[model samples]
Target: MAWYDEAIFYHIYPLGLLGAPKENSYDGVTHRLKELDPWINHIKEIGCNALYIGPLFESVGHGYETTDYRKLDSRLGDNKDLKRFVKKCHDKGIRVILDGVFNHTGRDFFAFKDIKENREKSRYKDWYCNVNFGGNNEYNDGFSYDNWGGFNLLVKLNQRNPEVKDYICDTIRFWVSEFDIDGLRLDAADVLDFDFMKALRAVANEVKPEFWLMGEVIHGDYTRWVNEGTLHSVTNYVMHKALYSGHNDHNYFEIAHTQRWLDGMGGSSGQGFKLYNFVDNHDVERIFTKLSNKAHFTPVHILLYTLPGIPSIYYGSEFAIEGRKEKFSDASLRPALNIKDYKDSVKNNPATKLVAALGKVRSETPELSYGDYKELHLQNRQYAFSRNYDGRSVVVTVNNDDNDCMLTLPAGNSVEYVGALFGERITVNNGCIQVCVKANSGEIWVPAEKENKKKKLVELQTITEAGKISDASENKGASGTKEKSDTHSDINGIEADSHTEREEFEPSYEETSESNPAIEAKMNSMAESKKNSKIDSQLNSEAESRSDSKGNYEEGVIAGLQEAILAIMEKNGYVTDQMRNDVYNNTHHDSLVNWVKSFIR
Candidate 1:
């Protein structure tokens, strides 16, 4: 099991976190971070273990392209305040990770500026791409400090340059030595060459080993970059692909898909874990708006916090922020920290109770996150997987459809259900556990007392006595009590329940998820027979659009069930206005998509 399992990461955009008076950029917040412990405490109280702060260095556009890598950006606070913040986080047992931007630096950065001013004669002349700066283009006009895509501020660094390498390496060493940060998320890692990165990493790791160095490798097979000598891991952008997987996708399930992609990475063949996973980050539309169906974000949240890899909740994602284009523009998604209790009645808002529950399960129990993973079940509408760690285990089931789901668990003894997203203990009825789940809700469990060997037999006996069993197999042909039979030796001395003539029970995912062919047939029959005007109008509009041979307009609405889930899979982030405009035709669906996107981006 990966160490990050069950871990809830709270990404904080430093410029906009907490309760501060209205102020201009470069000005300080009226309140200090010390005053905001109540908010940070609230997050800790809710179950977050690490804090991912946005760039805090001097910059032009935002914090990304830094002008000075060493000094703290005054707009945020000073170096002293940063030290205090890291100390506070450590005191609370939370880890801190700084944003490392070695790929490029702002044009005003001292190293590159000095190089430009002195040409080849400059001591720092090798710090940047060596060329005269005269024109707008790189290939056509040969400008030295060419804008990335013709922009003026972000100048690409000369990683081959030794002076530049030393500066970048020193910056990394400072964070680990000074603040004792646990990790570094390198920004724009793909922009730098291999040799430069390996050398810089050696310097950083010298200060503190086991430093989590996750990189933004974006797309393609970046295996060479993610090896042990380089990055510890790379963020799953393939899962980000799920955000745009034809609209009707489950954002959380998409994260689960990243597991497979990560499985394919590195020198191992289907052997290792991916670096980490994220739905939306600072550079994209809030995940809230990226989904096919904006109405089912709660399930997505539950999935992200529980899935196997290190999952990051991009700064404002918990609240579902909405935005267009990438990072800097995403500032609108960042909201001030809230101390007021977030009641469940608020329509599209994330369930605070749900986050707390998922977090508790992740941190307190090692099995669910840090154990061996076994895929117990997988269907189009339901996902059941187990993580077994330290002889303890947790089984998680996620139902992405708009219906209740039942999974035939790993059978042995009757197990107790700890809880689902509802934040309550679960009880079973009939043949199935009979969990009362709404559509788009999921449940996670560990091997219940009756099933777990870690418990004393007496405790196991107590759980079985609680009427959790509906079978004769659990009984040893006596008081329906648990006992080892004369001829059979089951693991944990669990008696045969199947042979014991308990009343037979059957589960019905067929009745819940519409994916069962019978359910689909029933839906088709209902469509042909029913006379509801509302659904018929939608069908008619869909039919008419398909019939339009000219294709004058783009029919952006997801056409099938997958599209439906994809539309709302992720809550929102990185969605361009073009994609949004293309996804739906009606105002109501659009509003729902936008609102749901706002909650998690």
Candidate 2:
């Protein structure tokens, strides 16, 4: 298999991540790209095996309007800096791919400048599209030229020109020989000429074995671009939209349908093509900002990694940072962030921990990378699917509702399955396994025989308390109404037997002492406290006193206090409905401060 087929990508917008200047001043090399050395280590620590960072070529602004395709942007550094960065990533066992902005160029590009200087006599007049000397543009260059998105500052390239194709092909060769990069992400590929892409693919194959070509295609059938000859994959925007909206709307069918449609298009193997899947990218609002309910962060990302595609996590998204787009500014979506500021909090952030767990699950499970897609169960708020290959399977189930959900899924002939995230083992009885998924959470259940191979997975002994199996046959829908049918079905809508006997299993906390000493100590303390019935009364008395002393606090102070309280609660997994109410509804500044202190203690 190709490296991309088994890759977990971490995307970085270097210009923004390094806090480079918005416009290139043509200054000397800055060595800003060297700052990414720590980020490269961070990426490996998070279990991401590939890095997709760029628009590193010289640009006028935002790293997209290319000025010199052959040179690194002065705001970032010289080409040598990039070479060392790529070498560092390779040393860390990470593959690198750069953004290939071939569809357009900035007004300051050498060829465009030549066009503006010589007018009709310039040899590079044909390099750009629709150059007419008779008409004028907003810049009053005494000529008109086709521009990308009607922005005259971005001159469109003439892909039909042979000279342009050769120049771009030669640039790719130079990049391969100098930087030794692995792949390229074609920008605005939907509008790129197919002939140019074919030529580019030919050059890619000639330059390096298994060199990948992915495109930024938002709409239409992705197969048009990700076939045998043109490109390997396109951004899975179809599923990207469905992933967030489906959770927000409590509709799993939307995502299920997209998965089935794309899989069918890839033919019977279902692994014939793999699109690049992501929750958010540099062009869109961060997933944290787009999600209406913050709790769905876990489930949404669970689907991103487990689904039948190459998964990617945009920079800063693992920490649940929020960013949204303004009318004409994308600055918010691409803010500068330093890993040092988030290092201590990375392990405490639930999303980051979950991402690390999912990365482990994806890396260790071979079925997830090469297996065929099959839907085993689907509902408005809950869904289950399995990836099977050569008699091995990994089942994934996600719940978006506010209450726990029990999913009974077909297990074929497998005797048992173990949870990859928490290492909870479930026996397959009567050709099925019923697993309880916590609210706003998900699980990856792998075949029992495969568990030994995944020794590095996070083994949470306390998750069973949160995932106790309950009777979901009469579970209510998101609207609080009971559903009539509870049978598992395949993607074809054929129902399986739902008459299996319900098994009652108590929550177990046996192995916590070895896996997690901190949790074991907390559990022991809770148990000892239960021996004293007077402890509850004493806590109630203290709470009443804190509530009684309400003080007038400014809104900003209250907001800051609330943020601190939540941060503490998040680290301890103590966030609950009552805690939210106490934090948000209480007006006493001293009470909030006490809560923070209590959490810290």
Candidate 3:
């Protein structure tokens, strides 16, 4: 398999992450790129094996308007600093990909400057698109030219020009030879010429074996760009939208439909292409701010890692930081942060621990990397799916509601499943397995027999016995023998069964009678320990959720609802500036709900 197929990517916008100046001053090198060394170690600690950081080339602003393709941005550092950084990443076994902004160049680029200085007589007049000396533009430079998103500052390139293609291809060769980079994330690739992408793929393959080429394609059929001659993958924006919206709207059907569409696009056997999957990126709002319910964080990431695609985590998102796009600026979405500030809280931070645990799970489980997708269960508030590979199956279930949910899913021929996160062993009866997923939580269940090899049999047996004890306790009657004390204490000094009131959705199991006090006492102790451990885990997770949800929950819900409505309207081409204003300005709960209902209809 190619390295990207199993790669867990950690995306870093270097200019934002390192606090480099937004505009290139053309001053001396600042060596700001070296600050990423700690982040590199942190990525490894979180189980990321690949890094996608870029737009490092010299740029006039935001790193996309390229001023010099051959040199590192002066605000970041010299080329030597990049070389050292890439070497450091490689030494730690992490693959690196840089942003390829080939479609456009800043107005200050040498070729563009030449066009401006020499007019029609310039030798590089053909380097840009639609360069007409007779007409003038917004800048009134005595010429007209095509640009990106109606921004004249970003001059579009003429990819059909042989010199331009050769220059870009040669730059790729330089990046490979000089920095030893592994791949490129082609910026604005949706508008790029197909012939140009084909040429890029050819050059990439020629320079290095298994060199990956992923594109920034927001819409349209991905097959057009991800075919053998073009690119290995494109940004999976369809799923990116579904992830946050599905959870916010309490609709799993949206997510399931998107998965089906992806499966259909990939053809029968499985998801043929490992499209890059992400919750949030530098261009959009952070997932923390996008999600209305903070508890859904775990489930969102659960799907990100377990779904059929290459998973990626945007920088600083793992810490549950909130960032939303302002009316005219995305500066909030890409804030500068230091890892050292979070060092003391890493262990206590629920999102951090969960991300790290998921990373470890993704790295260790081969099924997650190569498994075929299967939907075992689906509901508005709960979902279950399985990844099967080489006759081994790993099941993943998630609950998005504010209360616990009991999901009974098809297990096929599997007899049992072991929880990959907490080592909880669940028995399958009559080709079905029932799992009690906590509110806003998820579980990764590996077939018990397969998981057994990785874990000690004794420990597995102990856990199974404890599960049985807990199951029996659930069905015990009020007439049953009373315990010596009202509460049971565990090793961590946590109290279990402190309240007689059971949760509304707690499952009931068959009861059993134990005659021997010694044996029953031991089993009861083990069960209490298990229960206390779960309680401790829940407490930590809830603490994190509370910390993240410090703002008004009602306001978040209203904002999330408004965004969802706008997104749907935009998708349907019915959105207007007036509609957006109406949605944002009217904060009445009933009005927003009615608007959402109308859009849904």
Candidate 4:
């Protein structure tokens, strides 16, 4: 597995993580990473390996406005305090990654202040963007220099300006060399040019070669940033969009679209995972708000963790934080550390159980964590996919339907349970079993019985090819179902798609397709995420049933074992061919017709 492949990151807005009362929060607006150690420790107990802290460099409130490049924000704590926090986290095997906002700095940032006090005398006068602090004092409000779209408080740092580059580069070096930080997350990466980010990467890697650099670049394909070597990964925004879009401007089609994007990213690299996926972050409304409810957030959390790349949990999310466009300092949005409060809500709660279970499973099943992800069964929100490394395989299915879902496991009884991180033994009564998951819930299966190892790679290839074909028909409004499979077992009932899955996670309100008041709109603002990765649709629909039992079984069989052919041919990685395959009606390998007994009750 890639170092970050199985990594689960937890983000904490330092100033917002205090266990003590708000009166004892930040003296002013500064980072209190240490002051929040008690809370951070709690996150570790629950299992998080990385901490993505917002700007820690000296700055005003929000820490986005940096004053000193190397010093810590005095109001909250000091450099030593930060070191203590980092040391504690490292002691727990957690990596320390800071939010690197190189694109801009606080007005008091050395260069800007130097220019502010000594108009032309400062050598770095050109370093700030559009400063017209003259007689009319048009910028008397402050240095009018902006950050992208006129964010005066955060003056854009001119990375194109070489000297500006040296200072920022040195700052990163100081943090890594002196503190031994594990990674750097570049903020507003889209605004920064290629060279600037490349420079930052060079410096950070020099300090620690495996040091990760995740860009906050939204929109367009962020794969360019990773493939071009400017970053190790960017946020998985497509799935993020799916998490919030719900069934409004959304449907199973759009959600699966995001999964397709994720598969594409996974195929591109067998090393150095290139995506940091999450459901809710510091800036957006908490995941609970966007989901149908806290119950639904469970599936979304599973979606974030198991999907490709490194998964992250924003601080307070483990406790079910909820709100929309909350101000940075508001206690309601940034509540006190309260994992205990949520512990009950998640106890016996299937969704939370699934999330906790799968996160643990992801750690053990390296294939699921680090292997190639290919869709196997996707339809009606019962999205099923497999992650295979060498001969090891883990299959995952997310059932978004209200009715009990009976997923067929390819006529086999030799699958072992990897444990869903929490509960280990998934004792199915027989080869035929029934699963009852709330809408947006998932379960993963591992091959307990070994097949021909030589066919291992072949198996992966077949699944991938089948996935591509399925993906093509996804949004086209088609869904798949199990026909009379000779081997159909009780547990191996027909799987389903999102539309079908929605039966379980259905909204409280009726289909006012035009309006979605039923969805409890929390993030009424905007999502900073872009379409970086998406889901695929090789699945069948739970949305509808076949005309007859015989028709379902007749059509459910895989024809001719062509999966082997596709597997062999797919290795060449014909991305172009995969796209073209979607346009045509490709058939999958049909299996034995009368092998197993039906499971659906």
Cα lDDT computed for each candidate against the true fold: 0.52, 0.74, 0.74, 0.53
The pairs that clash in candidate 3 are none
lDDT of 3 by residue, 1-601 (tens): 8788789999998777776654467857888888899988899988899999988999875788888998999888899999999999999999999999999898899999998999989999999998988766545588877766434567889999999999999999999999999999998798899999999999988999999999998745678888899999999987887798889888887687678767767631244888999998877677888888877888999999999999999987888777654433344556667777668334556677778878888988888888898988878888899988888788899988889888888774678788876677889998788888878888899887754646632111000000001211221211232111000011001110211111111121112211233643565555545545643454344445544575756666666656655554443322335446755765655545554443211
Query: 1 or 3, which is superior by lDDT?
Result: 3
- lDDT per residue as tens, model 2, 1-601: 8898899999998877776665467857788899889988889877899999988999876677888999989888898898999999999999999999899998899999998899999999999998989766546688877766434557899999999999999999999999999999998898899999999999999999999999988745788999988999999987887798788888787788778667666642245888899998876678888888788888898899888889999988887777654322345556667677667444665667777888887898888888888889888888999888878878999998989988888885678888888777899988899999989888999888753645565532211111111121112221233322110001001100010000011112121112233553565455434423333344444445444454423555655666555543443222345445645665456555554443211
Q: Give candidate 1's whole-model lDDT.
A: 0.52
Score candidate 1 by TM-score against the native.
0.65
Q: After superposing candidate 3, which stretches have Cα over 4 Å from the reference?
A: 268-271, 344-346, 412-414, 449-601
Give the root-mean-square deviation of each candidate in angstroms: 18.6, 20.5, 19.3, 22.0
- The sequence of per-residue lDDT tens digits that candidate 4 reaches over residues 56-100 is 666654466677768776655678878887888888888889988
Q: Name the runs in model 4 displaced over 4 angstroms.
A: 19-32, 132-138, 141-144, 246-250, 265-273, 326-331, 338-355, 409-440, 449-601
Which ten contiguous residues of candidate 3 have the minimum total lDDT? 484-493
Task: Quickly count the clashes in candidate 2.
Answer: 0
